[model samples]
Target: MKNTIAERILDFLKGFPPFDSLTHEQLLIISKQVKVSYFEKDSVVFGQQEALHDCFYVVKDGAIGIYRDHTLVDQCDEGDIFGLRAIIRKDQYLLNAIATEESIVYGIPAKLIEEVLNTNIKANRFIIASFATNTRNPYSDEDKGTLFANETVLQPNASSFTEVQSASFSKNPITCIPNTTIQDASLIMSSSKVGSIIIAEDNKPLGIITDKDLRNKIATGKHQITEHVEAIMSTPVITFPDTITVAEAQIAMLKHEISHLCITKDGTIHSELVGILSEHDIIVIHGNNPSVLIKEVKRASSAEQLKQIREKAQGLLQNYIEQHIPITFISNIISAINDAITKRCITLSIEELKQEPPTSFAWLAIGSQGRKEQLLLTDQDNALVYENVTDDTNTKSYFLKLSEAVNHKLSIVGFELCPAKMMASNPKWCLSVSEWKSQFKTWITHPDTDKIMLCTIFFDYDHVYGNHDLVDEMSDSIFDAIDSYEIFLNFLGKNALTNPPPLSFFRNFLVEDSGDHKDQFDIKARAMMPLVDAARLLILSHEIKDINNTIARYNKLSELEPQNSDLYNSCIQAFRILLRFRTQHGIKNNTSGRYIDIDSLSKSDRLKLKGCFKPIKDIQELVRVRFMLSQMM
Candidate 1:
């Protein structure tokens, strides 16, 4: 009597996104409406330039290979949807969708989207984002040869964005004993179809034999094929840790003039080899270069023009999100773009003055920007520090005018003024190096509710431009102040615990009890800020100055306190999830991603978000207990 087939489909769809975000009732409607189609191996579901299907597909079983020409573009397994983008556009399929194996696909009616998008803005945004991220084809011939073929929807994909990403290396690296014959190594390489093989003894890498080694040594008759691998192997193999990044790997390759690198456990020759990274891996990941956007920002003469570029960078962000790029890597890419824009704004402001700086100074991005975790365009939180001058009044006046100019330009380029007047132009924040140092000391030595809050904001400052020494001096002064007033860290720790973690997203208990945006969750204040405050407090306690980003700070904390490594690591994961959620909401609503409507989240999203809450509660408790804040209260 039950609609078991539809119920089964509903169960499958509930585990995936977009649908997972829908209510059970809405999803059941969609499930019952879905038309099931089966295809044999290598069967075409839709062909390039073919008329659009009335419905888009979800793979019920097996795999779908989406091809543009003969090149495979994407692989869609179970839970992956295809043909939706074309249906959304009401256009012909631009790429061929073929069943790579015998598959059953569920085709959901296009009207389901109409029903969903009409009432659900969250679903609407997902559909829009998918359309924006998936396609690259021109709408018309006139659009070609411009900056992008489809300038309207084109955003940089994750592969093209700047790389601070961990290299996805060959984890099961091909290895041979040092005494193995060169011919035997070559045969092993041929069977595995890998370009390189490591020469190892007792799991420790001794050397590497790349294809070039064979080409240069054996082919040139410098070494015989029957000779031992060690005889011709490139000894002293360049070894790096498993945590090597794409940029680091690329630099290492160029620095040592070697293509293959052995990833070891301890980043030392004596450590056990864990993986291998080669130039090809880097090349495959390289796409829309973040450096290209940075260069564009530098060339812009006006803030208005820079604003256009910033809009384009959001496309990159969307693409990165759609591609499921690592959140930390995405943050790094966006922050780099933001920093470049700010630097350009300063340059333009300086040009407007028609006079050089009166003294050595450093412009800094504080708070979120300082941490380089500001993925969304939000209020500017910044400051300026100049070298101390005898004629402080005139010097302050000059810098005030400069800061105002810079802030105005920054505003035009999309970083709006902070409502709290926490910006360089505020004069309160624009101070000489000595004055800034004194301010830091005051905040530390004589801490209070207000000063502690200010400390949270200002302590995360990162130099954006101008003289570097001024920023370094300020940092050294902060450590000095903290050392002099050791209890200051406990104050900071207590402040970090003020915002308790959410109970979970299942109920309204943790959301705003009364607000204009009533019942909305303040993800920033409640979820993200707690983690940010904890990371900053913990790192500051350790006297580590270099790590400003919350993720990086937690990473450092993990290294410093291996005893509490799991807690710190969990915090890092939770922070990343929260930050990504905030950015996604910001993208959807076109506002600062600080607030979230608790009701709109999909079941999958709520559960994913709920999983992150436990870590927050644990970290906050750790902060409360470690600082022994009961006495302070």
Candidate 2:
């Protein structure tokens, strides 16, 4: 009897690891015996001290949280495996595995994993590496040599350190000429057992056709198989020099979102094509550097490819956090990757429109991204400002369409759509420079509760892609409006004080009273936001521009006000610690990092967090005194 579900399981398992190391026959056999389980949100699969189940679990959908003493220790999302530690140890579970969201999971029998561990060295090493990374007691000498007694555990290479290695490519690349019939090219590809075939003239690459092109064009009947390959092939192919490193190659593929890159002698279209590099080749090289990811984003041809790369970046981020890399460094690198992806999406959208913009436009990243504190994938908050035009209808239409495309792509790449529809794709947010100026004026002058909220989100705008002059003009306009309505800063100050300090008089955390995160501390709203609000208000009052980052703003403030330098420095330190803490929590629980489980934190961590609150309290008082917000409050 045929089992369709088993086949699907095999397909999914093949894409992820320890399973990826297994043979097809082994996977098929294991998949057939796999048990599928469903779990509701907050439902526990196993509790700490319970006897280990007969099998380990792999997440098929949604997420599972591994908790120690009711505190989340790790989160297992799609394709992630958990519970193996307990199985390997043959002991009571040390952590509780609970569904963080409604989920489907596959349970692979312990016997199968044991067999794989004994038979496959790579599978064993991967499991060991995963345990080393995930386990809280990884450095415990008793567990180190015990798991892999005979086999040595090879740690995964640091991504940044792997960038300089030379890249490997397919030397005997399959090729055709411009005049080759699509059918002939297809036959050649089939005969050669290749997914792509390059079209060249004088041994210089002209275009390329891949399996995607065939599926999208020939299979869809958009183009006939009898047509010349040139009619369907993707032209002006991305070419890289043979001297490119593994990191460079990987980045190239990601940047263009293309699966294949043409390797040429001189790294130019004018040079002779020598070889071909595919995404598969880069994956095989195992270089997961940020530079490589940025390149991948640049070469990404579709949103889906960018999405895969972004997911890979999450893993990289987790590794960095675990390694205790500087939080500022991590933030800067991730922000650069995010900015690059946004820019590439914009570039791709323009190509899709097949026309130049009628006027200069600037894409503004607002909120966390604007402040350059985005360390994890979060909702996109952006707006667009274009040059004023006499007949604005056509220009607006063009930009709206462009924004729609860019926003959709950004969403696909892991940035969630703004729940409030604060994206540029929204017509209200996408406006000409003049309209944007007028809108800012209204919000500043009016300064109502809603308007102040909007001001907090929008005022920290950073130019992501497009005309800097336009963004500069927009900034200038904001200062001009604030100058006219000086009292607006008081309203901003009042809003900043709304959250108050995160700690009570007894130094207890202020947890949520109600909602999904009732018992959890709202880190963003209570801790991070107060600092963010203070920075924006203070910076704006000084009429500073081009300094959207919270840390940078505080640093600038410290420099400008030597008398208040201590408070500003304290604010900076608090903001940095909180930012890192939030990022680690997000990574641990696969969450937004807005809510923190107080039970999960160690005493030292709690003390550190508590210490940060004093700065928040001091900052609020300073704002009150500076802006005279007592009456407003």
Candidate 3:
């Protein structure tokens, strides 16, 4: 064991629990003796009724689920301590500790804990309290204060979380008399601060007029305001009962493409109008509307404001998936918000630079940002592509300065700079079109692991700002390079299959066996990315470009390979469901939805997850045959 790694692990542990109360020398001594262990999915660290080891474990990475009688009682993520209960009680383990995914953990000797307790009063009190809080009173602690806390521990009915939460409603709706003119309807709507007006007949909703109707019909001179409310109103309006949830309302509006839905006593025109549900009301609750969020992004001048807006967008994403809004639409809206954020970053960077960019350059968002499926806030993957500058030795320095500014501003706007320094500020990543072409040629021809990693990152580039022509030219060069080096696709195929779908005999999910996340599956690597990588490889083979989004690629594949349209369509559907599952898990845990504890999932959710695996297995089979990877496997 590296002393540095052991010291680092001790440093983390000393900040928390019983370890915190121990003397520095004592803690460091225990840390040095700690046994570092790793686990694959489903592997048991310690089973119920089994004698405890000399050491109790602390999760260093991933999760460890504690199960009693096959029911998960608690889950310990990063820095969470487990396995001490058995030692404390002087009995065999009452619950099983299983790795929730491939994870790293440190086993600190229980003897050291005893030594600290015997010598230090403070350490003893802390140890007793940790045991009381975590083991004896598990429910009253972590469960009560955290949002979505119910999801962390295993339970029944896990999948039945509200599909659409009840959105708060406006009790009073704007109304107009049947005889009211279109002009008057407009005035009432404006004064009432509403986007729609309900045309009521005998106190019952007869029709509705929205801003769109006035703009599309009256403003275009298709109709005059002098026309009565009935002339312009859309009769037999869509209505729902007051109990309609934000999810349902969003779906209704998107399905109809209308701005308003009447809320009546019985959800129909025959019933009395009780309230109004307008698109604005839904947008307020929906949280993720790109149009509304972009407006917020435009007005945001500070990092704090952008953070709040970004948080709201996360909720919006949750609602979008729950409502079954097509993934394509979801990706588009998210992409718009992401672009708006990047644009704001650019503006902020320029201000901080105290000067404008020296030359025209396109800001390219690579990887998930480029694919537009980035619902989660992750490290920024961006590059800069400037117009070729000739005869000026000073041009390189100017562009470099500009990239530094842009990268810094983007970091402030919530995109953490890539740790590998793949951002535009890295001169190697920020290249002119001709330079990028040569770089692509080198990577394609070489196709080593390092080059492949770069190819993966750069392949997903989507222009966030500046010249579209330059981006198109770069893409054209990429395809040309691929066409000339056919073996490069095989290299990609091998890389795609590197992490095979995590399924075992009888099609059960293969989770990590030991370490911190024992018995948990990595949904991202084992499921989602296989599909994503496969889609990328197949699309590249078809010589298709500019389609980075996974779902879009599948949609395009459906059109291109009519012979395999069924499988392609199935892939799209499966991808959508899996993406949603991963996003929900991520949101609930406040972490990337890569590692998933199988015990926490309800039977139905497990089945639903299993259903997604079918298509994955089928698709991988397709990839294997198409690429002749059977022998390679």
Candidate 4:
């Protein structure tokens, strides 16, 4: 029988992949033969161009730095597989690996790994993923497709990676003579259905006439119809080279305060104009401009159009994430777009009803939208706050009809009906302002599971489409109620600490043990939601409002609590890494980023994840002491 250490190694190896497909007995046999090696900090494991070792390594402890031509390429730590590139390619080592810290590693014979792979299909896939991950382009790809490939696994999660690329612009541009009349330019624009006409001389763009130019310059009597194109055109057109990315194009438009960019062969007007890229062209190709999408939402009469637009927004989200754009900025942009769509839905619903709203009412985007941290399409959590009425039944009936239309429109626009029916259309949610304040008071005074659930969902409310005063009044009442009952914060803090971060008893990963999720890590409950929930609870305790995003809340906390600034700052850093990790994992596996298959991750990734647990551990300890909740559990 293999010793306990070998069996333990085999068990871990079996869960992770290429080894998972091997027979238990065979793996056990091989594990026993594995040689354990130790290296001091900065000690060279192998040098570039060195002949390959007989064995490749699995990191047991600490980190190893991989360098190509003396430039660091990657860091490998626990559970990481390294030195196998040489074995795989059957070439000399192309990178030098040195210990980043005192480290222990298990050296498995190259022959054994090959033997394991000979029969295991799953193991073979794992090997392919490992190679693909390490060699994937750093500039072009973000490790989005290297994890898993099953359709069932890929659909539920939303990611801020793996975006649909912007459509390539046409290179051959049509130009016009610089001295053409406004009349001729109008004819050209009519024939083209394009909003702008680029005026050029000798194939070089000189100026541009857009619909705006025609309206403001010609129609408004700033210039005559018989005038030269230059008289009615905006001079010195914005220009970019053919190599501009979709993102760069968008930025250029915003930066230079111009709509049409003359695509010049050399990116300067002195060069020949190859093509003209209009703002409308960008809107059609990219589908993400907030203003353009809002207009599309307004015109969309069908559900499918809204769905396609929403799906395109997901791609935009992925790009924002990859660019390392601030999550707050992403959330604001997405929420503004989402809010516009919702407002348009309300308008459509009112039109469908053939009756205006009977009284002033506010549509509240409760939960994540209220806190403004909504990054994924989870569900529609909302409510309604209406002006008080003498006849409750008549008011209720009027608003319920309006809400039903609004809710239906929202579903058509890609917001799935809230599973718990926590929606405006539900009578229980559509309440007068006084009633909502009473509800808040009750939840605060009598805290229980149901009350907690209600508080958790409702307290993070943002005014979606409503009377501003009603929302402000609601907010005032809520803070007043909380001020009267300070223990509400304690209750919230207790709830935050409920699901302690899932570090195992021995400080290893506590993976899901059975069922469909067996051998996978619960990233949501174990990692993400804990941080999110903790941030919400912490922010609420401080009586802060409208900061729902996890990382942003931590950043605010860092500023507010300067003495514990390091802790809050670490939380922010940890949350960013976790968010990025989840996004990359979700994009790769096409899953909801809630669970992670441990075997699919390389040893280095596992170590990086393990590093994230440090913040989770420290923060949870802080929560315990601050809340003084030793007796709660």
Q: Which candidate leads the pack in lDDT?
A: 2
2 or 3: which has the higher TM-score?
A: 3
Better of 1 and 3 by lDDT: 1
Give the Å shift of residue 175 in candidate 1: 49
Tell me the alpha-carbon RMSD of every candidate. 26.2, 25.5, 29.1, 28.8
Clash totals for all models, in order? Answer: 3, 17, 18, 8
Q: What is the alpha-carbon RMSD of candidate 4 to the true structure? A: 28.8
Go through the candidates in order and give each one's C-alpha lDDT: 0.81, 0.82, 0.75, 0.72
**Please, what is the TM-score per model?**
0.57, 0.57, 0.58, 0.57
Expressed as tens digits, the lDDT of each residue in 18-89 for candidate 2 is 788889998999999999999999999999768778999999999897666664445677888988766765
Q: How are the candidates ranked when ordered by lDDT, highest leading?
A: 2, 1, 3, 4
Worst 10 residues of 2 by lDDT: 145-154
Q: Which candidate number maximizes TM-score?
A: 3
lDDT of 3 by residue, 1-633 (tens): 558977887898887765776777887888889899998878899997587699899888887877665644566778778887556645456577898788888998888766876798765654443332222222235322211212243222222222223555677989998889999999999998777889997768989988768877899998898989888899878989977765466556544656578888988888898998864464345243344466668767876677777777777777666656555556666677778878887777678768766667788999888888787777888888878878334665766777787677667666788898988889898788778889999999888998987887789889898888889989998888888889898888888887766679767788988998888998887888888888999999999988898888998998998998899888888888887788888878887787999989999999888888777778888888899887776
Model 3 residue runs over 4 Å out of place are 1-167, 170-239, 242-289, 391-393, 514-516, 631-633
Candidate 4 lDDT over 1-633, as tens digits, reads: 538889878877776445656787888888988988999998999987588789898888898877655544566767778887567645456578999799998899988767766666556545553332222221123233222221112211222112223324656555578788899889988887777788888888888887767867777887888888978777888888876555456555644656668888899989988887765455344335443355556666765666776776777777666656555556666777788777877777778878877789999888766766666766788889899988889888888988888778778766888889999999999999899889888888888978987887787788888798988887777778888988777787777777777777887788888999897898767876667777877887777776666777888988898998898888777776776677667656656576898888899989888877778878878877888777675
Global lDDT for candidate 3?
0.75
